[model samples]
Target: MTRPLALLALLVPVFTAAQPVAEAPVALDGTHQVDLVSEVNGHPYRLYIAPPEGYAADDTTRYPVLYILDGRRTFPAAVTARAFQDIYDGLDEVILVGIGNGEQTFDAWFSHRWRDYTPSANAATDSVVAVQFSQDPETVVSGGGPDFLRVLREEILPLVDSAYRTTGDRGLTGQSLGGLFAAYVLFEAPGLFQRVGINSPSLWWSDGETFATEVAFAEAHAALPAHVFLSVGSEEGRSMVPPMERLAEALRSRGYDGLTMDAVVFADETHTSVVPAMMSRTLRVLYGRSE
Candidate 1:
């Protein structure tokens, strides 16, 4: 499996040398792209969109939409994975939309994610908020998740749903803190997305406080109205995954209706190398045809 660019690497120097000297140009079999600007709550965001393979200006075939967080860093790989699975495994072709920081530079994009992906400092998620990118306080943005989701629900989703043929079946994919945000959405706005692929979620964030939120959600709702695909590297920090297991067990014990969920730990994958296979596997489980 190819390594997905770890934003943490871009922020921390110890992982700097792992990055390639030069970024290769992105090439794909069937893809389309558009750049968009969104101003929500005084914050401007950059959105990079890719409609499904063979999309037409006048076609009425509504397709599933996949919203990828950290678009600048993850879009190319997602486009390629979507196309490959759509063809080889007979998965449904999807509308791919990448949400990026308006800033095109890596440092800025990486930094901005900290602000957009983390939830606000509630008593629950504040105790363990450790800013890793302390060397540059500027790179460590946190607790702006609600505004970011608003941009998606109110701005980006409406734009695509209006312009393209869409089924309104939305799926979200993100890593680390982005994964944490996705998990938050599962409870906070369970109706917003139909499918979610949360890879290597930083459950360690805030000492995995989200686990309590999930349990509370399960108690409140009789059914979870989404398909969820969760994954983590087997070697990810020991504390990172046990919470996910407990979460899965809790959900399983509830027997919630309309919910099909699975969590897998890739045997040999690490945080930096899990995303490509993670996305590929996640798309298959979420949308691919079963044998």
Candidate 2:
């Protein structure tokens, strides 16, 4: 019996090894890529668009759009999370538009994101980030956020609207520096997006310039008619957590009519580890079906 068992194990290994291998990876369904150039900044962008399951060009049903920042790293996660939420939690379906810089290397991607996401150029903040990443401060150039926003408004939005059937209900989500950019947009042009998700934002940028932006917005505008979801990891440290909580508090204290804001701190999660949970929760909060 022992000899037969040994022979069966060897046969099992041989059989498993004999199985055919796939020639190529299976692509995600209903997903397509679009390469576009930003007329505002002259930067090229790659959009990874994932339409909802069962989407069709001939179908007259229009869907909402969710623009995701850091598309290269976050797109797949967003797509998977959205699909699962829709399947299991009865979440509403929306088109996912991931904006990527088309960088092949991590260093190139890092530099490009730093340039586009920051609201202002600060040599002091640049030096700190440079040291953290082992990069030279001179190599990191920021202050392109305004232009990037223009690229989104004048270029990307039009392209997306023209290419797809959309309901004009827009959502924007980002993490870290991307989150910082989202916050900038929320204050700079609150009307652009109906839903905003800020996850682990680097509010420490430019000495908390985003707070000043918020103050300015609140001064001029009586109400902000948007759904804002703010979240952070409990382990993201004082620099991230306290500032985010402060922002939440400030927004709450304003008593802005028509503004629905929710802030959450996920325990046992770090900045890098909390992304999936944050994304999932953001979608549920912002787009969950009404009971």
Off by over 4 Å in 1: 1-32, 122-131
| TM per prediction | 0.82, 0.92
Tell me the tens digit of each residue's lDDT in model 2 across 59-84.
99998999999998888888888888
RMSD of each: 10.4, 2.1
- lDDT comparing candidate 1 with the true structure: 0.76
Predicted model with the maximum lDDT? 2
How much RMSD separates candidate 1 from the native structure? 10.4
- With a 3 Å backbone cut-off (N, CA, C), the pairs that clash in candidate 1 are 114-141, 115-141
How do the residues 74-122 of candidate 1 rate in per-residue lDDT, one tens digit apiece? 7777777877676675677777877776576656766577778887644
Off by over 4 Å in 2: 1-26, 136-138
